[model samples]
Target: MRPPYFIPADRTIDYQLRYFQAKQLHQAVVIDNNSRAVGLITLEDILEELVGAIQDEHDFA
Candidate 1:
């Protein structure tokens, strides 16, 4: 697989998702204030998160 995609930790969730989808990155690195790696997020992880969020919204509705 390609090297982990890197995204700034401070980026908004919407921007991060758009950027990752645009680059077709399988995974991403959430870089921190000191430019240190804080976490790794995969495409599958993103999808799962989205699904969970949708379910939550649906429940609330």
Candidate 2:
């Protein structure tokens, strides 16, 4: 099983991307200041946030 990873809710998109790449993480649970899970995030989400949404051929225009 993969180890669990968490990211602060207030973190910047750039920082999050670097953290994910450094740790080789595809996704992680987002946490508030108190370490409560707020949501989930993925590398794809980070990339899309940086460069706008990514749509594949299967996606409708």
Q: Candidate 1, after superposition: displacement of residue 51 in Å?
A: 1.5
lDDT digits (tens) for residues 1-61 of candidate 1: 5766788888876787798889978788889989899998776667676665434444665
lDDT of 2 at 5: 99
Best by lDDT: 2
Please provide TM-scores, in order, for all candidate models, with all chains considered together.
0.67, 0.88
lDDT by residue (1-61, candidate 2, tens digit) is 9989999999999999999999999999999999999999999899999999999786798
Please tell me which predicted candidate would have the highest TM-score against the true structure.
Answer: 2
Q: What does candidate 1 score on TM?
A: 0.67
As a whole number from 0 to 100, the lDDT of residue 53 in candidate 2 is 91
Estimate the lDDT of model 2: 0.96
